[model samples]
Target: MEPSEDTSAVSPVTPPPGCPLHSNAVPLYGEALAEDDTERWERLRKRFGGLAPVKVEPEVAAWLILGYEEHRQILRDPHLFTHDGRISRELLEGRLRPEHGTYPLVNYRPNALHNDGAEHQRLRTALVDSFEKLTSTRVRAAIEDLANDLIDAFAADGKADLIGQYATWIPLLTLNRMFGQEDRHGYFLCELMVKLWNGEGAEAGAADQAMVEYLTRLISDKRRRPGPDITSWLIAHPAELSDEEVTQQILLLIAAAHDPTTHLIGNTLRLLLTNMDLRFSLAASVIQIEEALDVTLWQDPPFKTLIGRYATRDTTVAGYQIRRGDMLIPGFAAGNNDPILRDADGNPPHAQRPVSRAHLSWGLGPHSCPARGIAYQIAATSIATVSARLPDIQLAVDPGELRRRPSPSINGLVELPVTFAPQQPLARPHRAEPAPPAPPAPPAPTETVERPRTIGGIWDRVSGAVRAWFGV
Candidate 1:
């Protein structure tokens, strides 16, 4: 597909009446966007230069920035391209209807993701400072312990779904630890988050409410009794955060950190298993998982699209006139494969792209992901842990048989089935009761742990054992 700027790549489908979009707009959210995204990106780029107009919903139109330089321009300039959606033109003009089910997404909140200027600085600094306190050496040790324990729960079975048993748990368990909660809360919160994201009908809504209530309670408890955790750090920050503000930050951090980090680990695992060069090197212990992680971030970013960065005012980007309130999304995956970074045929330079460090997956500017530093640590640690524990692991099914999760927003597999050499399960963490104040109590009772009899409940048993650390 030779690059063209003919402006004739209009879709056959038409936008609804009163839709404030261009004539050539195409649907941005669809199976095509997720399934054959590279092809769709190429087709759209050939006609629309680096930025293409797209219909977000049937009635809403927005710009999809697909060029590397275009991404830098939009992401780096806060004055022109702000993160705040409250000042959006469609919104102010009454085009963004409340019943459309997306108003809440665009509505302004006090969190860092939705704010600008000093407020963003304060909130982001609190997060950065908190993370800095968690030195990499300490963080890695904790993650290594968590990964090893999780592996112990299922390694004896000889086979397991990496996604269900491993990849998915690291982020949730880590979040609970960071928030200074016990294993029980992680189990409770993990179930709630899973239901919130994957449950059906009223189940999703109920789970969301329950999670909010739980977090609120956790924050209140932390205020009364501070601990050496992220929540306590936020609560005691110089910013003097209110309970609601702390709650907002926790919600933002968790939502931003969990899925992306989980998928990053999962994708990296898939690459190391399927790519022969990396596979051989990994088996020989000569390959750094960070390189594999970089490749995954460039090729299969955790998030395919970050929708709705609105124009603060009328502006021209890449020679196109922009209207105030027009929405734009920084196409991270597309920008990583922009023509400038690609060959004359518009294919990414496979030999060089992975080694190059220009991917926008972590984003840019003030609104960039605050959790990026720890995300790398968690993903690399998780991958390293798996490789160390299951050196001979191989895919249970053909690579092509692996299925993606059904969401255009995320690039992740539904499950990763693998087989490895069975090993003796490690001793689970156990809790012991304390002595009485009056007299030496009958030797403090030790709690006995019951391992799951079947592999089906490995996640619950292993993850539930985290309570031993907190004495909960």
Candidate 2:
């Protein structure tokens, strides 16, 4: 461990003396819809004084790392900053006496978010294989078929909400296709995902529980009658895992795959529509799709906030004095936007000629996301297919009208409205010559005023209220 620096002599910006335990909760970037102004991220940089301290729970504190070089270093050095919340959980749950003692729901540990070393490697390896199976060629081809079918239905209408019709459809249907899992559970999982990532949960405790219940049932059915699906694979290899462990991993996998892809698709639509020049550029150069994806991820990653380790021993990060047990957050959001690290003019770092400014979308070092390649490939191919097939797509609704889930962790629109000219792939237009004819112009029609009906207002309200109350 590195020796601790003197906190006393370092640049001192005293925190409020005695605020509420969670007062300095440190609103993450993009938490507040208004403050998400990306323009201000540079201004906020000066306030860090090398380290920005934040409160997670009322008493649980963590440092938000923003400096590009230091953030890179912390992510690389796994020894000093530990991801295993088992240590922190013991403190919060009063499990210091026994590691497995029950406490608040927050005290419980999940699969491998907080693990390191060989255990971490094992968990990650399993997940990598799972993802490979998830995004295989056969699975992608199935997704392509689904996308084409959905497009065919909407082409006749000339207008449809992209999120409602396509973006949401692809991911949900892809998940269903890959796992052969059903959304017979309704949009419950999607809604839960939006809430969990957004960190807006009165039922955060019950969120994972709900997933656990669903996955448990899924794993059980698969075990009884296995197939060539992901859940079946998990059942086939239960040697290193118990039934419950298998269930938990599946739940985690489903959640990870669902939200990230949803946001990636959603964000891609928003970016493409807003930047028409970039959109046209991409449409023109099909081969440039990969670079476009790299740029999109660098500019705006789907998940902006992620949890990380607390220092196990005295350590220095970004030249700030960090004591043992101080929580550290590797801010993916902040890192991607760091002006000193990226070109403010908006040139994405090329993979072939990688510079110091590569986006930390998949993260860095040991715990980096293993499924990034799959995510990129899936997102890229989906967009490429659309661009090649329908180059004239545009927003159906006003750009400002689309709403993003007001969550800091996940950044994607709740609804995205889009429109495009309808055309059948197999049908071709025929040209014909027309003869001109002389005719008088018709007079314009007069506008008519409609009478208001007031008697039915109460009846309509009562009926609407009843339907809402009963959730009809």
Candidate 3:
């Protein structure tokens, strides 16, 4: 269906000044909506009802799906509410330009997150197959080991910014290991991920381009020397994906992995440290870290709102008219706390809620997160490891003083300042040096070699080549 040209379908009510949905207001993409999301969502719900039209960019307005059922309906039926939208088309047609101050969100590329039909299925299958290697047992062990290593770094410091030192590093390290990346490239990927998340237009685009180039090199190397890693697995998959396809898949995987996992770890930790009821439940063994993770997912998912699902045709959702080409966002956080799903006191009725994972935190439908189990394992294990080691860990500052990072795509803490009792670093095994090679068999009996050559010349050449190859 062609896009509707009718503007009257949108609410004619004039928004008051400073309202996010107001036509004259600045685009709401930063800390304002994310910092205090609960109150802000409530206000938006009250003002605009469920399907509210809000500005994602200065001149771009989209309907934010705030109702629980409405959100689910949109997700369930991709035919009516599809992921393919005008922004993506514009991006493909080279009509979308990136300014230094603009967010590079709608610069769509063909990946699982931005596609539909058979193409999405193909890309998603490759991604799912790659992640299948990360079994729950393996993920738990790796996360636990990485978490402890991070803790060991600051265990004796008595105070540490858990967000910076622990939550942030754990996922990055784990992903790097899974991708078979050295520490240098892993750190570089982390830097670029942050730049893409927080930087604007030119900077963000450059970071993304750099990531593609880096991943291309990484994929090329993996092709030459396949290893027991995700990248190698992708390269060897029966799909026979080209270099660009493999690079895009890996880029999407990395992008999806880092932000959500980091925030999941951070948000779950925040709950455990600050929510006394949750802490007591954990201490009494009434609830596991996984339950706390569920609560956090339900209450404060990492991404408050998702981007760019345009209506395939003119339709009405929850009493609001959705014209074709109108952008629709699934308010995952808001929908999770929709009034219809909550009790009279405005809280989730835990007892009456369905046993199924109904929360939109990991999203819904065919486009839902594929690596959610691994994500959960990473988060749960990280929290458990920290709790076991730092039994007395507490927030260093008042809860209200903490700030959320400014981004439309994420709801994460800027820093989680935490204090715990100082303790000795855990002991780790030392690497054993290789035994000297039997003096080269006494220079072979038949060879009457001259004794004038320098002793370390051959070793130097070998070490230099190794260092050069590995970029060490």
Candidate 4:
């Protein structure tokens, strides 16, 4: 593809004294850490051009690509900018120690996200085939059921933290169900997942190890008794992935699903509640839930910056020199707000050209998110279910006081406190009470074990066993 003239060259500018580019201690957490990202990014763009240098965690300096067209070009050509996790050339050369908080981010793993060429294709194919089982209708129904059940837990109280009660739990429960895990195990996994993302010290390391062991056992169980779920589907795929490979794939899927989906729901809800025009449009049936989600994707993507990509060879991007083994971070949030794409008032220039769905929120090229459609379905259903069930719901806290979680990769709120009119629980007419059992029966001869009478019964037993074994 031809490069756009707008991104042809970046004007040269000298970095100010003690700027992020010149200092090793300056941290880069994207707009989430900025009080006002729009003004901040615009200032950075002018000062250092599009490819500005900055520091990530553990005092590692890297380049932050802030141009939309340049970001797209780098993402599209993975051969030049690979997604392998070997970002720190100094560490590989025995020049740096592995005692930093950012060690995990640069550690290589045998998964699609950390590979290129045929290996990436093989791993990604297995994942894509397994995800195909999650049809749009199935995903929508599953998320809706999970969302409603979560809301029901706090509905009578008329007030709840939407992030804890609804946004976070819906994806956790849905993903757990898809992996054929019980509610107890699901809850435990959710706790560990959060710790893995936000915890510090030995506690975080322990949580990470525990998660791997649990998933390893789950994969073994699936191999022994295959079922109609994502894990089983992956095991049965033509790729014939080993237990270790399957475990890595499962971890990737869960991690990828959890934060992004949770944030998408939270961010969209924030927009709907805070923007009167959007709420009015929804009330008047002037816009659909999908449009609301699109707006959120364009404005507040869950991942403000795509994780680091390493340069394969010396190259020039947007007229900026890039050295081999140098780390390049794609600015998804900043690129979305590129001056070339936005009007003077900081809105998308939709009137001048067709609105394209080419946003970099999901990345681009070969390594882009394979479950993009399912993500959209999950977010849309979640937002719609809550909004429809509680039309009077509103933000409980002042919008100005809301805070973002402290993470280098994720862009999400710390909490979303919301309130709604109190209402009674919905009546469940189909639920039937179990009949009373007879007096104790005689002991079975030779202590013979009884098998479940139906598929549902078998699933319940298996789920119970897994949950019990996990002590969840």
| Winning model by lDDT | 1
Candidate 4: list runs displaced more than 4 Å: 1-26, 29-35, 93-97, 197-206, 343-346, 349-355, 429-472
TM-score of each: 0.83, 0.72, 0.80, 0.82
Question: Could you tell which candidate, 1 or 3, scores higher by TM-score?
Answer: 1
TM-score of 1: 0.83
Give lDDT: candidate 1, residue 309.
89
Candidate 1, residues 1-472, lDDT tens digits: the string is 1221222232233434654355667876544445477888888889888998886655556889999999999999888887888776556555554444344556566678877788889988888888877778877876877787678778889998998878877887777788887655666766776665555557765665566557766776787789999999999999987776777788787767667888999998998889988778656756567767888888888887776688878888877888877888888878888878876666664345346556889998888788888898999999888888888999999999998765445778889999999997655454232111121111211332222222111111122112111111
**In candidate 4, what residue range of length 10 has the lowest lDDT sum?**
454-463
Q: Which of the two candidates, 1 or 3, achieves a greater lDDT against the reference? A: 1
Ranking by lDDT: 1, 4, 3, 2
The CA-based lDDT of model 1 is what? 0.72
Question: What lDDT would each prediction earn against the true structure?
Answer: 0.72, 0.56, 0.68, 0.69
Q: What's the count of clashing pairs in each model shown?
A: 1, 2, 0, 0
Which candidate leads the pack in TM-score?
1
lDDT of 4 by residue, 379-406 (tens): 8889888888898999998999898765
Worst 10 residues of 2 by lDDT: 452-461
The TM-score, computed over Cα atoms with residue i paired to residue i, of candidate 3 is 0.80
Q: RMSD of model 4, in Å? A: 10.5
**Which stretch of 10 consecutive residues in model 1 shows the poorest summed lDDT?**
455-464
| RMSD per model, one decimal | 11.0, 15.2, 12.0, 10.5
As a whole number from 0 to 100, the lDDT of residue 40 in candidate 3 is 71
